[model samples]
Target: MSDDVTQDAVLIFAKRLGEIIATCEVSAVWIDSREPCAWQYIRRDGETIIVTCKTLQYWAVRDAAARNGYRLDVKPDEMDVMPGQQITRGIPHADKLSTLAVTPYLSGNSETIFRSAWGDGSEYPTLRRMLRYASTADDLGRAGVIGKTAQEMYGGPLNSSSKVQRARDTGAKEWRALSASLDTARDELIYRSTRPQKDD
Candidate 1:
Protein backbone atom coordinates (compact mmCIF):
# COMPACT_ATOMS: atom_id res chain seq x y z
CA MET A 1 0.00 0.00 0.00
CA SER A 2 1.05 3.57 -0.66
CA ASP A 3 2.05 5.88 2.26
CA ASP A 4 -1.04 8.05 1.69
CA VAL A 5 -3.38 5.06 2.02
CA THR A 6 -1.63 3.87 5.16
CA GLN A 7 -1.91 7.36 6.70
CA ASP A 8 -5.64 7.57 5.89
CA ALA A 9 -6.24 4.15 7.48
CA VAL A 10 -4.34 5.22 10.62
CA LEU A 11 -6.39 8.40 10.87
CA ILE A 12 -9.63 6.49 10.59
CA PHE A 13 -8.55 4.01 13.23
CA ALA A 14 -7.51 6.79 15.60
CA LYS A 15 -10.85 8.55 15.18
CA ARG A 16 -12.76 5.36 15.93
CA LEU A 17 -10.59 4.63 18.97
CA GLY A 18 -11.16 8.17 20.26
CA GLU A 19 -14.92 7.76 19.87
CA ILE A 20 -14.86 4.49 21.79
CA ILE A 21 -12.80 5.97 24.60
CA ALA A 22 -15.03 9.03 24.83
CA THR A 23 -18.08 6.80 25.33
CA CYS A 24 -16.33 4.91 28.13
CA GLU A 25 -16.59 6.31 31.64
CA VAL A 26 -12.98 7.41 31.86
CA SER A 27 -11.85 9.46 34.83
CA ALA A 28 -8.82 10.85 33.05
CA VAL A 29 -6.63 10.26 30.01
CA TRP A 30 -2.91 10.98 30.26
CA ILE A 31 -0.38 11.10 27.42
CA ASP A 32 2.89 9.78 28.86
CA SER A 33 6.06 10.81 26.98
CA ARG A 34 8.72 9.32 29.21
CA GLU A 35 11.06 6.50 27.89
CA PRO A 36 8.35 5.07 25.68
CA CYS A 37 5.66 7.30 24.18
CA ALA A 38 2.41 5.97 25.61
CA TRP A 39 -1.08 6.78 26.77
CA GLN A 40 -2.59 5.89 30.13
CA TYR A 41 -6.33 5.90 30.60
CA ILE A 42 -7.82 5.51 34.07
CA ARG A 43 -11.44 4.43 34.22
CA ARG A 44 -13.94 5.51 36.85
CA ASP A 45 -13.42 2.07 38.48
CA GLY A 46 -9.78 3.07 39.28
CA GLU A 47 -8.37 0.52 36.86
CA THR A 48 -5.16 1.88 35.22
CA ILE A 49 -3.48 0.67 32.04
CA ILE A 50 -0.45 1.85 30.06
CA VAL A 51 0.12 1.89 26.29
CA THR A 52 3.86 1.67 25.75
CA CYS A 53 6.02 3.34 23.09
CA LYS A 54 9.64 2.45 22.38
CA THR A 55 10.76 6.02 21.61
CA LEU A 56 9.21 7.83 24.63
CA GLN A 57 10.07 7.78 28.30
CA TYR A 58 7.44 6.65 30.82
CA TRP A 59 9.36 8.36 33.63
CA ALA A 60 6.52 10.70 34.59
CA VAL A 61 3.78 8.19 33.86
CA ARG A 62 3.55 7.13 37.48
CA ASP A 63 3.12 10.71 38.68
CA ALA A 64 0.57 11.46 35.97
CA ALA A 65 -1.38 8.35 36.93
CA ALA A 66 -1.36 9.39 40.60
CA ARG A 67 -2.52 12.92 39.79
CA ASN A 68 -5.44 11.48 37.83
CA GLY A 69 -6.34 9.25 40.82
CA TYR A 70 -5.14 5.99 39.35
CA ARG A 71 -3.10 3.39 41.23
CA LEU A 72 -1.41 0.96 38.88
CA ASP A 73 -0.96 -2.60 40.14
CA VAL A 74 2.54 -3.06 38.73
CA LYS A 75 5.72 -1.77 40.39
CA PRO A 76 8.60 0.09 38.71
CA ASP A 77 10.82 -2.99 38.46
CA GLU A 78 8.14 -4.88 36.59
CA MET A 79 8.62 -2.61 33.56
CA ASP A 80 10.77 -4.04 30.78
CA VAL A 81 13.07 -1.15 29.91
CA MET A 82 14.79 -1.26 26.54
CA PRO A 83 16.92 1.30 24.69
CA GLY A 84 13.95 3.15 23.21
CA GLN A 85 11.00 1.51 24.85
CA GLN A 86 9.49 0.61 28.22
CA ILE A 87 6.81 -2.06 28.55
CA THR A 88 4.57 -2.67 31.52
CA ARG A 89 3.35 -6.15 32.55
CA GLY A 90 -0.15 -7.50 31.80
CA ILE A 91 -1.51 -4.98 29.29
CA PRO A 92 -2.55 -5.29 25.66
CA HIS A 93 0.39 -4.87 23.25
CA ALA A 94 0.54 -3.26 19.83
CA ASP A 95 2.98 -4.14 17.09
CA LYS A 96 4.39 -0.62 16.56
CA LEU A 97 2.58 1.81 18.92
CA SER A 98 1.56 3.66 15.74
CA THR A 99 0.04 6.52 17.68
CA LEU A 100 3.52 7.82 18.49
CA ALA A 101 3.86 9.01 14.89
CA VAL A 102 0.94 11.40 15.42
CA THR A 103 1.80 15.01 16.18
CA PRO A 104 0.58 16.61 19.39
CA TYR A 105 -2.20 19.19 19.02
CA LEU A 106 -1.88 22.11 21.44
CA SER A 107 -5.10 24.03 21.94
CA GLY A 108 -3.95 27.64 21.99
CA ASN A 109 -1.35 30.28 21.12
CA SER A 110 -1.09 31.71 24.67
CA GLU A 111 2.11 29.79 25.26
CA THR A 112 3.99 31.97 22.77
CA ILE A 113 2.96 35.16 24.61
CA PHE A 114 3.78 33.56 27.97
CA ARG A 115 7.19 32.37 26.81
CA SER A 116 8.00 35.77 25.29
CA ALA A 117 7.06 37.59 28.50
CA TRP A 118 8.98 35.10 30.65
CA GLY A 119 12.04 35.23 28.43
CA ASP A 120 12.11 39.02 28.65
CA GLY A 121 11.51 38.76 32.46
CA SER A 122 8.82 41.46 32.38
CA GLU A 123 5.70 39.57 33.46
CA TYR A 124 6.54 39.68 37.18
CA PRO A 125 6.97 43.45 37.45
CA THR A 126 4.00 44.13 35.17
CA LEU A 127 1.76 41.95 37.33
CA ARG A 128 3.03 43.58 40.49
CA ARG A 129 2.34 47.08 39.16
CA MET A 130 -1.16 46.09 38.14
CA LEU A 131 -1.84 44.65 41.58
CA ARG A 132 -0.56 47.80 43.28
CA TYR A 133 -2.72 50.07 41.14
CA ALA A 134 -5.79 47.97 41.80
CA SER A 135 -5.17 47.96 45.53
CA THR A 136 -4.87 51.76 45.63
CA ALA A 137 -8.18 52.42 43.88
CA ASP A 138 -11.21 53.08 46.12
CA ASP A 139 -13.79 50.28 46.30
CA LEU A 140 -16.36 52.06 44.13
CA GLY A 141 -13.80 53.29 41.60
CA ARG A 142 -12.12 49.88 41.47
CA ALA A 143 -15.39 48.09 40.86
CA GLY A 144 -16.35 50.54 38.10
CA VAL A 145 -12.96 50.23 36.46
CA ILE A 146 -12.91 46.47 36.62
CA GLY A 147 -16.41 46.21 35.21
CA LYS A 148 -15.60 48.56 32.36
CA THR A 149 -12.37 46.74 31.63
CA ALA A 150 -14.10 43.40 31.56
CA GLN A 151 -16.77 44.79 29.27
CA GLU A 152 -14.14 46.04 26.84
CA MET A 153 -12.14 42.85 27.05
CA TYR A 154 -15.04 40.53 26.46
CA GLY A 155 -16.76 42.60 23.74
CA GLY A 156 -19.27 44.36 25.98
CA PRO A 157 -22.12 42.60 27.77
CA LEU A 158 -22.76 38.98 26.90
CA ASN A 159 -26.14 39.96 25.41
CA SER A 160 -25.84 43.69 24.81
CA SER A 161 -24.22 46.00 22.26
CA SER A 162 -21.97 47.65 24.87
CA LYS A 163 -21.37 47.29 28.60
CA VAL A 164 -22.20 50.95 29.37
CA GLN A 165 -25.50 50.62 27.53
CA ARG A 166 -26.19 47.41 29.39
CA ALA A 167 -25.55 49.15 32.69
CA ARG A 168 -27.85 52.06 31.80
CA ASP A 169 -30.57 49.69 30.54
CA THR A 170 -30.34 47.66 33.73
CA GLY A 171 -31.06 50.77 35.88
CA ALA A 172 -27.44 51.57 36.63
CA LYS A 173 -27.17 48.68 39.09
CA GLU A 174 -24.16 47.61 41.19
CA TRP A 175 -20.95 49.42 40.21
CA ARG A 176 -22.75 51.67 37.75
CA ALA A 177 -24.84 53.12 40.59
CA LEU A 178 -21.66 54.70 41.97
CA SER A 179 -21.55 57.02 38.95
CA ALA A 180 -24.42 59.11 40.36
CA SER A 181 -22.74 59.41 43.75
CA LEU A 182 -19.48 60.51 42.08
CA ASP A 183 -21.31 63.20 40.12
CA THR A 184 -22.91 64.53 43.33
CA ALA A 185 -19.53 64.68 45.02
CA ARG A 186 -18.05 66.58 42.10
CA ASP A 187 -20.90 69.12 42.18
CA GLU A 188 -20.41 69.67 45.93
CA LEU A 189 -16.65 70.21 45.42
CA ILE A 190 -17.26 72.76 42.63
CA TYR A 191 -19.81 74.69 44.72
CA ARG A 192 -17.45 74.84 47.70
CA SER A 193 -14.55 75.96 45.50
CA THR A 194 -16.57 78.86 43.98
CA ARG A 195 -18.27 80.08 47.19
CA PRO A 196 -16.85 83.12 49.01
CA GLN A 197 -15.29 82.51 52.41
CA LYS A 198 -16.89 84.10 55.59
CA ASP A 199 -14.95 86.94 57.23
CA ASP A 200 -13.02 85.82 60.36
Candidate 2:
Protein backbone atom coordinates (compact mmCIF):
# COMPACT_ATOMS: atom_id res chain seq x y z
CA MET A 1 0.00 0.00 0.00
CA SER A 2 2.77 2.40 0.98
CA ASP A 3 5.49 3.43 -1.46
CA ASP A 4 8.23 1.76 0.57
CA VAL A 5 6.29 -1.48 0.71
CA THR A 6 5.63 -1.45 -3.01
CA GLN A 7 9.32 -0.83 -3.70
CA ASP A 8 10.18 -3.66 -1.35
CA ALA A 9 7.83 -5.98 -3.23
CA VAL A 10 9.44 -5.12 -6.57
CA LEU A 11 12.87 -5.64 -5.10
CA ILE A 12 11.90 -9.08 -3.87
CA PHE A 13 10.44 -9.98 -7.23
CA ALA A 14 13.54 -8.82 -9.09
CA LYS A 15 15.84 -10.88 -6.88
CA ARG A 16 13.84 -14.00 -7.63
CA LEU A 17 13.73 -13.23 -11.35
CA GLY A 18 17.50 -12.77 -11.63
CA GLU A 19 18.18 -16.07 -9.93
CA ILE A 20 15.76 -17.89 -12.21
CA ILE A 21 17.16 -16.40 -15.45
CA ALA A 22 20.79 -16.95 -14.50
CA THR A 23 20.73 -20.68 -15.16
CA CYS A 24 19.23 -20.48 -18.62
CA GLU A 25 19.76 -18.74 -21.95
CA VAL A 26 17.87 -15.46 -22.17
CA SER A 27 17.84 -12.60 -24.68
CA ALA A 28 16.49 -9.97 -22.34
CA VAL A 29 14.34 -9.49 -19.25
CA TRP A 30 13.22 -6.32 -17.53
CA ILE A 31 11.30 -4.68 -14.73
CA ASP A 32 9.41 -1.44 -15.10
CA SER A 33 8.56 0.88 -12.23
CA ARG A 34 5.55 2.95 -13.20
CA GLU A 35 5.78 5.48 -10.39
CA PRO A 36 9.11 6.92 -11.54
CA CYS A 37 8.96 5.48 -15.03
CA ALA A 38 12.10 3.48 -14.40
CA TRP A 39 13.17 0.26 -16.02
CA GLN A 40 15.69 -2.43 -15.13
CA TYR A 41 16.95 -4.28 -18.17
CA ILE A 42 19.01 -7.47 -18.04
CA ARG A 43 20.63 -9.13 -21.00
CA ARG A 44 23.42 -11.71 -21.36
CA ASP A 45 24.69 -10.85 -24.82
CA GLY A 46 26.68 -7.85 -26.02
CA GLU A 47 23.55 -5.75 -26.31
CA THR A 48 23.45 -2.69 -24.06
CA ILE A 49 21.78 -3.59 -20.74
CA ILE A 50 20.80 -1.64 -17.67
CA VAL A 51 19.66 -2.80 -14.27
CA THR A 52 19.42 0.46 -12.48
CA CYS A 53 19.89 1.57 -8.89
CA LYS A 54 20.94 -1.73 -7.32
CA THR A 55 17.65 -2.06 -5.50
CA LEU A 56 17.21 -4.23 -2.45
CA GLN A 57 17.34 -7.07 -4.93
CA TYR A 58 20.96 -6.39 -5.90
CA TRP A 59 21.96 -6.00 -2.29
CA ALA A 60 20.10 -9.19 -1.53
CA VAL A 61 22.14 -11.03 -4.11
CA ARG A 62 25.21 -9.07 -2.99
CA ASP A 63 26.87 -9.29 -6.40
CA ALA A 64 27.56 -5.83 -7.70
CA ALA A 65 29.91 -7.01 -10.44
CA ALA A 66 27.35 -9.42 -11.83
CA ARG A 67 24.89 -6.68 -12.76
CA ASN A 68 25.19 -3.45 -14.73
CA GLY A 69 23.53 -0.61 -12.86
CA TYR A 70 22.20 2.73 -14.02
CA ARG A 71 20.46 5.57 -12.23
CA LEU A 72 16.79 5.48 -13.12
CA ASP A 73 16.49 9.17 -12.24
CA VAL A 74 18.71 10.08 -15.20
CA LYS A 75 18.32 9.45 -18.91
CA PRO A 76 19.38 5.91 -19.77
CA ASP A 77 21.52 5.32 -22.84
CA GLU A 78 20.04 3.89 -26.03
CA MET A 79 19.80 0.12 -26.01
CA ASP A 80 20.21 -2.14 -29.00
CA VAL A 81 17.12 -4.08 -29.93
CA MET A 82 16.65 -7.45 -28.27
CA PRO A 83 17.83 -10.46 -30.25
CA GLY A 84 15.35 -12.67 -32.13
CA GLN A 85 12.95 -9.78 -31.96
CA GLN A 86 12.17 -6.73 -34.07
CA ILE A 87 10.22 -3.55 -33.42
CA THR A 88 7.16 -2.76 -35.45
CA ARG A 89 5.56 0.60 -36.17
CA GLY A 90 2.29 -1.17 -35.63
CA ILE A 91 0.91 -4.73 -35.48
CA PRO A 92 1.82 -5.30 -39.21
CA HIS A 93 -1.02 -7.73 -39.50
CA ALA A 94 -1.13 -10.30 -42.28
CA ASP A 95 -3.83 -9.04 -44.60
CA LYS A 96 -6.41 -11.18 -46.38
CA LEU A 97 -4.02 -11.98 -49.25
CA SER A 98 -0.82 -11.91 -47.17
CA THR A 99 0.00 -15.59 -47.63
CA LEU A 100 -0.90 -15.65 -51.32
CA ALA A 101 1.12 -12.67 -52.59
CA VAL A 102 4.72 -13.32 -53.68
CA THR A 103 6.03 -9.76 -53.42
CA PRO A 104 3.24 -8.51 -51.26
CA TYR A 105 3.20 -4.85 -50.31
CA LEU A 106 4.95 -5.16 -46.96
CA SER A 107 5.36 -1.88 -45.14
CA GLY A 108 6.69 -0.54 -41.82
CA ASN A 109 10.02 -1.34 -40.22
CA SER A 110 8.33 -4.38 -38.73
CA GLU A 111 7.30 -5.81 -42.07
CA THR A 112 10.23 -4.42 -44.02
CA ILE A 113 12.82 -5.93 -41.70
CA PHE A 114 11.65 -9.33 -42.88
CA ARG A 115 11.12 -8.18 -46.45
CA SER A 116 14.54 -6.60 -47.16
CA ALA A 117 16.96 -9.20 -45.89
CA TRP A 118 19.53 -9.13 -48.74
CA GLY A 119 19.45 -5.50 -49.86
CA ASP A 120 20.85 -2.37 -48.27
CA GLY A 121 18.46 -2.60 -45.34
CA SER A 122 18.81 -6.35 -45.07
CA GLU A 123 19.23 -8.33 -41.84
CA TYR A 124 22.24 -10.48 -42.81
CA PRO A 125 24.54 -7.48 -42.62
CA THR A 126 22.85 -6.52 -39.38
CA LEU A 127 23.30 -9.98 -37.96
CA ARG A 128 26.93 -10.06 -39.08
CA ARG A 129 27.60 -6.79 -37.35
CA MET A 130 25.92 -7.85 -34.10
CA LEU A 131 28.34 -10.78 -33.48
CA ARG A 132 26.11 -11.95 -30.61
CA TYR A 133 22.59 -12.12 -31.96
CA ALA A 134 21.24 -15.63 -32.13
CA SER A 135 18.22 -17.81 -31.49
CA THR A 136 17.00 -21.36 -31.93
CA ALA A 137 13.70 -22.66 -33.18
CA ASP A 138 12.80 -22.89 -29.55
CA ASP A 139 13.53 -19.22 -29.03
CA LEU A 140 11.68 -18.15 -32.19
CA GLY A 141 8.76 -20.36 -31.25
CA ARG A 142 8.76 -18.69 -27.86
CA ALA A 143 8.86 -15.33 -29.64
CA GLY A 144 5.74 -16.47 -31.59
CA VAL A 145 7.05 -15.66 -35.08
CA ILE A 146 5.53 -17.49 -38.01
CA GLY A 147 8.68 -19.27 -39.21
CA LYS A 148 11.11 -20.99 -36.89
CA THR A 149 14.30 -21.55 -38.88
CA ALA A 150 15.91 -19.90 -41.91
CA GLN A 151 14.90 -23.01 -43.76
CA GLU A 152 11.33 -22.55 -42.66
CA MET A 153 11.57 -18.86 -43.47
CA TYR A 154 13.21 -19.21 -46.89
CA GLY A 155 13.61 -22.86 -47.87
CA GLY A 156 17.19 -23.72 -46.83
CA PRO A 157 20.38 -22.24 -45.52
CA LEU A 158 23.01 -20.94 -48.01
CA ASN A 159 20.20 -20.71 -50.53
CA SER A 160 18.43 -17.40 -50.20
CA SER A 161 16.35 -17.65 -53.36
CA SER A 162 12.88 -17.18 -51.94
CA LYS A 163 11.27 -13.74 -52.08
CA VAL A 164 11.22 -13.52 -48.29
CA GLN A 165 14.74 -14.93 -48.22
CA ARG A 166 16.11 -12.49 -50.80
CA ALA A 167 14.89 -9.60 -48.70
CA ARG A 168 17.51 -10.64 -46.11
CA ASP A 169 20.49 -12.08 -48.04
CA THR A 170 22.16 -8.92 -49.45
CA GLY A 171 25.06 -10.54 -51.32
CA ALA A 172 27.24 -13.63 -51.39
CA LYS A 173 29.66 -12.33 -48.79
CA GLU A 174 26.98 -11.31 -46.32
CA TRP A 175 25.09 -14.50 -46.94
CA ARG A 176 28.11 -16.73 -46.34
CA ALA A 177 29.16 -14.75 -43.32
CA LEU A 178 25.70 -14.92 -41.81
CA SER A 179 25.50 -18.65 -42.38
CA ALA A 180 28.79 -19.26 -40.60
CA SER A 181 27.95 -16.82 -37.87
CA LEU A 182 24.63 -18.45 -37.16
CA ASP A 183 26.27 -21.86 -37.18
CA THR A 184 28.68 -20.77 -34.50
CA ALA A 185 25.96 -19.07 -32.51
CA ARG A 186 23.81 -22.17 -32.64
CA ASP A 187 26.72 -24.36 -31.68
CA GLU A 188 28.07 -22.40 -28.75
CA LEU A 189 24.87 -21.02 -27.22
CA ILE A 190 22.39 -23.84 -27.37
CA TYR A 191 20.59 -23.82 -24.02
CA ARG A 192 19.14 -27.32 -23.77
CA SER A 193 19.60 -29.32 -26.93
CA THR A 194 22.49 -31.73 -27.37
CA ARG A 195 22.99 -31.28 -31.13
CA PRO A 196 23.74 -28.18 -33.18
CA GLN A 197 20.69 -26.07 -34.06
CA LYS A 198 19.69 -23.42 -36.60
CA ASP A 199 17.28 -20.52 -36.30
CA ASP A 200 15.83 -17.67 -38.27
Candidate 3:
Protein backbone atom coordinates (compact mmCIF):
# COMPACT_ATOMS: atom_id res chain seq x y z
CA MET A 1 0.00 0.00 0.00
CA SER A 2 1.07 3.56 -0.63
CA ASP A 3 2.32 5.55 2.35
CA ASP A 4 -0.79 7.78 2.39
CA VAL A 5 -3.13 4.82 2.26
CA THR A 6 -1.21 3.14 5.06
CA GLN A 7 -1.47 6.25 7.19
CA ASP A 8 -5.21 6.60 6.61
CA ALA A 9 -5.81 2.97 7.47
CA VAL A 10 -3.79 3.33 10.63
CA LEU A 11 -5.76 6.38 11.69
CA ILE A 12 -9.07 4.59 11.17
CA PHE A 13 -7.93 1.55 13.10
CA ALA A 14 -6.58 3.70 15.92
CA LYS A 15 -9.88 5.51 16.34
CA ARG A 16 -11.89 2.29 16.33
CA LEU A 17 -9.52 0.98 18.98
CA GLY A 18 -10.20 4.06 21.08
CA GLU A 19 -13.97 3.48 20.92
CA ILE A 20 -13.55 -0.08 22.10
CA ILE A 21 -11.26 0.86 24.97
CA ALA A 22 -13.44 3.76 26.08
CA THR A 23 -16.53 1.55 26.12
CA CYS A 24 -14.74 -0.74 28.56
CA GLU A 25 -13.88 2.15 30.92
CA VAL A 26 -10.16 1.72 30.50
CA SER A 27 -9.55 4.64 32.94
CA ALA A 28 -6.37 5.58 31.03
CA VAL A 29 -5.43 5.70 27.36
CA TRP A 30 -2.23 6.47 25.48
CA ILE A 31 -1.18 6.06 21.88
CA ASP A 32 2.18 4.67 20.88
CA SER A 33 3.25 6.82 17.94
CA ARG A 34 6.44 4.88 17.47
CA GLU A 35 4.71 1.51 16.99
CA PRO A 36 1.65 3.09 15.36
CA CYS A 37 -0.58 1.29 17.83
CA ALA A 38 -3.07 2.31 20.46
CA TRP A 39 -3.06 0.01 23.50
CA GLN A 40 -5.17 0.02 26.62
CA TYR A 41 -6.22 -2.17 29.53
CA ILE A 42 -10.00 -2.24 29.52
CA ARG A 43 -12.29 -3.65 32.21
CA ARG A 44 -14.72 -6.29 31.02
CA ASP A 45 -16.78 -8.76 33.01
CA GLY A 46 -14.90 -7.82 36.18
CA GLU A 47 -11.54 -8.42 34.56
CA THR A 48 -8.89 -6.53 32.59
CA ILE A 49 -8.18 -7.05 28.91
CA ILE A 50 -5.09 -5.57 27.34
CA VAL A 51 -6.02 -4.97 23.71
CA THR A 52 -3.62 -3.83 21.00
CA CYS A 53 -4.36 -1.95 17.77
CA LYS A 54 -3.19 -4.35 15.14
CA THR A 55 -4.40 -4.83 11.59
CA LEU A 56 -4.70 -8.48 12.39
CA GLN A 57 -8.15 -8.31 13.97
CA TYR A 58 -7.96 -11.95 14.95
CA TRP A 59 -4.81 -11.38 16.97
CA ALA A 60 -6.34 -8.49 18.88
CA VAL A 61 -9.53 -10.44 19.52
CA ARG A 62 -7.64 -13.49 20.68
CA ASP A 63 -5.47 -11.42 22.98
CA ALA A 64 -8.47 -9.66 24.47
CA ALA A 65 -10.26 -12.95 25.04
CA ALA A 66 -7.17 -14.42 26.69
CA ARG A 67 -6.74 -11.42 28.95
CA ASN A 68 -10.39 -11.34 29.99
CA GLY A 69 -10.54 -15.18 30.35
CA TYR A 70 -13.58 -15.23 28.04
CA ARG A 71 -14.28 -17.71 25.31
CA LEU A 72 -15.83 -16.05 22.28
CA ASP A 73 -14.89 -16.14 18.65
CA VAL A 74 -14.35 -12.51 17.60
CA LYS A 75 -14.21 -12.73 13.86
CA PRO A 76 -11.52 -10.64 12.22
CA ASP A 77 -13.90 -8.99 9.76
CA GLU A 78 -16.54 -8.32 12.38
CA MET A 79 -14.34 -6.71 15.02
CA ASP A 80 -15.54 -3.12 14.87
CA VAL A 81 -16.07 -0.60 17.65
CA MET A 82 -19.10 1.65 17.94
CA PRO A 83 -19.41 4.49 20.46
CA GLY A 84 -22.75 5.67 21.87
CA GLN A 85 -24.63 4.28 18.85
CA GLN A 86 -22.64 6.35 16.33
CA ILE A 87 -20.44 4.73 13.74
CA THR A 88 -17.91 7.53 13.86
CA ARG A 89 -15.23 7.81 11.19
CA GLY A 90 -12.55 10.37 10.17
CA ILE A 91 -13.32 13.87 11.54
CA PRO A 92 -16.35 12.38 13.28
CA HIS A 93 -14.04 10.21 15.32
CA ALA A 94 -12.17 13.18 16.70
CA ASP A 95 -15.43 15.03 17.25
CA LYS A 96 -16.85 12.10 19.18
CA LEU A 97 -13.78 11.95 21.36
CA SER A 98 -13.99 15.70 21.89
CA THR A 99 -17.52 15.30 23.20
CA LEU A 100 -16.39 12.45 25.44
CA ALA A 101 -13.32 14.17 26.85
CA VAL A 102 -13.92 17.92 26.55
CA THR A 103 -17.52 19.03 26.09
CA PRO A 104 -18.96 20.44 29.30
CA TYR A 105 -22.23 22.26 30.06
CA LEU A 106 -22.01 24.69 27.17
CA SER A 107 -23.35 25.31 23.63
CA GLY A 108 -22.83 27.55 20.57
CA ASN A 109 -19.98 30.10 20.29
CA SER A 110 -19.37 30.20 24.04
CA GLU A 111 -18.41 26.56 24.17
CA THR A 112 -15.99 27.27 21.34
CA ILE A 113 -14.51 30.20 23.24
CA PHE A 114 -13.89 28.42 26.54
CA ARG A 115 -11.91 25.58 25.03
CA SER A 116 -9.84 28.06 23.04
CA ALA A 117 -9.10 30.09 26.16
CA TRP A 118 -7.85 26.98 27.99
CA GLY A 119 -5.76 26.06 24.98
CA ASP A 120 -3.88 29.35 25.43
CA GLY A 121 -2.59 28.10 28.85
CA SER A 122 -4.28 30.51 31.23
CA GLU A 123 -5.43 28.91 34.48
CA TYR A 124 -8.20 31.02 35.97
CA PRO A 125 -8.62 30.90 39.74
CA THR A 126 -12.18 29.52 39.74
CA LEU A 127 -15.29 28.76 37.71
CA ARG A 128 -16.42 32.33 38.31
CA ARG A 129 -13.40 33.76 36.54
CA MET A 130 -14.04 31.47 33.59
CA LEU A 131 -17.69 32.50 33.18
CA ARG A 132 -16.96 36.20 33.65
CA TYR A 133 -14.64 35.98 30.69
CA ALA A 134 -17.36 34.48 28.50
CA SER A 135 -19.31 37.69 27.75
CA THR A 136 -16.21 39.71 27.08
CA ALA A 137 -14.84 40.20 23.57
CA ASP A 138 -11.64 38.64 24.78
CA ASP A 139 -13.46 35.42 25.66
CA LEU A 140 -15.61 35.46 22.51
CA GLY A 141 -12.50 34.88 20.44
CA ARG A 142 -12.17 31.39 21.82
CA ALA A 143 -14.39 28.58 20.57
CA GLY A 144 -16.83 26.88 22.95
CA VAL A 145 -15.64 28.85 26.00
CA ILE A 146 -19.07 29.27 27.52
CA GLY A 147 -20.12 25.70 26.83
CA LYS A 148 -17.00 24.05 28.16
CA THR A 149 -16.38 26.36 31.10
CA ALA A 150 -19.92 26.08 32.40
CA GLN A 151 -20.38 22.42 31.59
CA GLU A 152 -16.98 21.24 32.83
CA MET A 153 -15.80 23.89 35.30
CA TYR A 154 -19.04 25.11 36.78
CA GLY A 155 -22.08 22.90 37.41
CA GLY A 156 -23.85 23.45 34.07
CA PRO A 157 -24.28 25.86 31.15
CA LEU A 158 -25.04 28.93 33.20
CA ASN A 159 -23.27 31.21 30.74
CA SER A 160 -25.50 30.11 27.90
CA SER A 161 -27.73 32.80 26.41
CA SER A 162 -30.91 30.77 26.73
CA LYS A 163 -30.37 30.03 30.39
CA VAL A 164 -29.35 33.62 30.99
CA GLN A 165 -32.61 34.80 29.46
CA ARG A 166 -34.63 32.42 31.60
CA ALA A 167 -33.02 33.80 34.71
CA ARG A 168 -33.68 37.35 33.48
CA ASP A 169 -37.33 36.77 32.64
CA THR A 170 -37.84 35.51 36.18
CA GLY A 171 -35.99 38.53 37.69
CA ALA A 172 -33.44 36.13 39.09
CA LYS A 173 -30.40 38.32 38.59
CA GLU A 174 -28.89 36.73 41.66
CA TRP A 175 -28.16 33.55 39.74
CA ARG A 176 -26.16 35.38 37.10
CA ALA A 177 -24.48 37.49 39.74
CA LEU A 178 -23.58 34.44 41.75
CA SER A 179 -22.07 32.84 38.66
CA ALA A 180 -20.31 35.80 37.03
CA SER A 181 -18.99 37.39 40.24
CA LEU A 182 -16.93 34.31 40.92
CA ASP A 183 -14.17 35.44 38.51
CA THR A 184 -12.02 38.39 37.42
CA ALA A 185 -14.44 41.27 36.77
CA ARG A 186 -16.11 40.65 40.15
CA ASP A 187 -19.31 42.39 38.94
CA GLU A 188 -22.42 41.16 37.21
CA LEU A 189 -22.49 41.91 33.51
CA ILE A 190 -24.78 44.92 33.15
CA TYR A 191 -26.19 43.84 29.79
CA ARG A 192 -26.76 40.34 31.12
CA SER A 193 -30.23 38.87 31.43
CA THR A 194 -32.57 39.56 34.41
CA ARG A 195 -30.67 42.71 35.47
CA PRO A 196 -32.75 45.87 35.81
CA GLN A 197 -32.16 48.38 33.03
CA LYS A 198 -32.14 52.16 32.55
CA ASP A 199 -32.47 53.86 29.16
CA ASP A 200 -29.07 54.88 27.77
- Off-target runs (Cα >4 Å) in candidate 3 are 1-15, 21-38, 59-200
Cand. 2 TM to true fold:
0.15
True lDDT of residue 6, candidate 2: 43
Q: Candidate 3 lDDT, tens digit per residue, 72-163?
A: 44432332343322121221112223232221212223434444444432333343444565656454766555454444443555467664
lDDT of 1 by residue, 1-200 (tens): 22443444455556545654554343223345322233554445675443333211232343334344434466445334555334333333333323322222121223443343344434243333334446667874545544453354456454344655543344335324334444454445445645899999
lDDT of each: 0.41, 0.37, 0.40
lDDT of 2 by residue, 14-125 (tens): 7655664554333222323222211233344434332223333443332221233322234323342355332212122222222212111111122333333334435554
Clash pairs detected, candidate 2: 116-167, 117-167, 117-168, 117-169, 118-167, 118-168, 118-169, 118-170
Alpha-carbon TM-score of each model against the true structure: 0.18, 0.15, 0.17
Global Cα RMSD, each model: 25.7, 20.8, 20.4
Q: Which portions of model 2 show Cα errors greater than 4 Å?
A: 25-200
Candidate 2 residue 76 Cα shift, in angstroms, is: 39
- For residue 195, model 2's alpha carbon misses the true position, in angstroms, by 19
Q: Candidate order by lDDT, highest to lowest?
A: 1, 3, 2
Steric collisions counted per model: 11, 8, 22
Best by lDDT: 1
